[model samples]
Each structure stands twice: as C-alpha cells, then as structure tokens.
Target: MRGALGVFIVRPNPDAGWSLSDADNGEVLVFESGGQAERLAMALARQAHATHGAGEVWVYDRLDRIVGRWRVAAVGMALADVDETAKAA
Candidate 1:
C-alpha cells in the first residue's frame, strides 16, 4: 500500500503448485498451477496499480524458485528509476 509494495508468489509446503500473497499478508491462495497462479497475480497487481499506485510483483515456482519480477505500471517510470534520475540532475 506504500513504498516498495509487493505481491509475492510462493509455494506452501503442503500444496503442489503456486500460492499468492501480499507482502503485508502472507500466503493467500494455494492455486493449482504455476501459469494459472502467476496470471491471476499479474491481473491483481495491474488492478492494484490502477487503483492504488505503482508497485511490483514477484513470481515463484513450487520449489520456491523465483521466476521473475514484474513492474506494475501506473503512469510514469519506476520509483527507483525516478530517484536515480533525480540524483543525476
């Protein structure tokens, strides 16, 4: 909801696929497949970005391996990028 907000994808010990959560709250859904879970997370992140603000989403596999990080875009550049630009000015 604030700075460096994230929705993380994880695999709980008991589940066979992927799970989604906000960093504020851990492990929400124990989904059936990686593709399904990640797609849903992406949609959720985009919606949040649209309503709240820009943030990030990280995807992970069932083995707890990170897939990649996604930038949930609202309008301008990423916050870190903006900070870097200001520092250069």
Candidate 2:
C-alpha cells in the first residue's frame, strides 16, 4: 500500500467495472465497483501519506471526468482534504 507519495486515480474500466491506478508507476488494480475501487484508492493514498507525508486520490466517473479528489498533507495534518473543485469538474 505504502510506497511513494503520488497520485492515485480510480477510473472506470472501458470493458467492465472499475480500476485504480498509481499515477507514478502505472500499476493498476481492478474492482467490481466504483465504490470498491475508490475505497482502496483512498486507503492507499492514506498509507502513502503516512509513509511519505503527502498523497492524493482522484476518482473519475464513467464518462472519464474527475468526480472526486482527496489530498493528504504533511504528517500530523488532516488525513484528507476533499477538493470541492473536483466535484465541480
């Protein structure tokens, strides 16, 4: 889970369910539902933040538009800051 500080994206798979990818490494994981993919992405982002002091998770809808974004700041800071702008996008 914890590896490097980077962005994680949860996006719909073209042929099926959902997928979570590490923006830094191109590693991908597939899940049956968006909720499942998002949850894992958030958990991984949190772990990365705890390990590296910063991390981010971006959730995209089926249309490939970013729908949600969560960012974790430096250690001891809030675990997540949900960006309202992403919802607006």
Candidate 3:
C-alpha cells in the first residue's frame, strides 16, 4: 500500500447517489450504484499507472483497518512519500 490512502468521508448527493471525498488528488467520486465506488477506484488506479506487485489502493475505515485493496504498478514518488509517512508515524 502506497500513495494517498484515507477513510473517505461520504454523504448523500442530490445529483448523484453517494459521494466519497478525501480520495486521490482531493477529488470526489460519485457513485450511482453500490459498485461504483470500486469502479471509480479502478479508474483511479489505471490513471495512476498501477498494475500489480508494486503499489495498491487500500480503502480503510475510520479505525484504519483495510477494507479492500486495488493492485497497480509502483508509483515512485507516491511510494516514497508513503514510506516517509509510515516512518514518521
């Protein structure tokens, strides 16, 4: 697990159904159906050039427990930052 990972704050949206914030790049991902969250995550992973073995998207709860992981290629800067954050923490 690397890059930016946080427990997204979610709320109901009038236009959409649900909205997740504090995601990658401070963007909000809206989902119409239940599985759209995963779809949005997959798209984010693809954009981040993630494939497998190197880095992944970890969705966590408020307790910092991982709920899911989306595998992708290693992102260098992102990984380094994550490492630094981990060391600091």
> In lDDT terms, which candidate is top?
2
Better of 1 and 2 by lDDT: 2
Off by over 4 Å in 3: 1-18, 21-24, 50-55, 61-64, 73-89
- TM-score of every prediction relative to native: 0.62, 0.75, 0.42
Model 1 per-residue lDDT tens digits across residues 1-89: 21345554444435365667776555477777767776777777777777767555665444555446666765532323433322422
| lDDT rank order | 2, 1, 3
RMSD of candidate 3 to true structure, Å? 7.9
Q: Alpha carbon lDDT of residue 47, candidate 2?
A: 83
Q: Which stretches of candidate 2 lie over 4 Å from their true place?
A: 1-4, 73-89
Instruction: For model 1, name the residue pairs that clash.
Output: none
- Write model 3 residue lDDT over 1-89, tens digit each, in one string: 22354323334466646555544357776777536665555555555554333333444344443444545544332322344433533
Q: Tell me the whole-model lDDT of each prediction, alpha carbons only.
A: 0.57, 0.75, 0.47
Kindly give the number of clashing pairs for every candidate: 0, 0, 5
Query: Of the candidates shown, which would achieve the greatest TM-score relative to the real structure?
Result: 2
Candidate 2 local lDDT, 1-89, one digit each (tens): 32435778888999999999997788999999989987888788778888777678877788876666778765422434345634333
Residue-level error in angstroms, candidate 2, position 46: 0.7
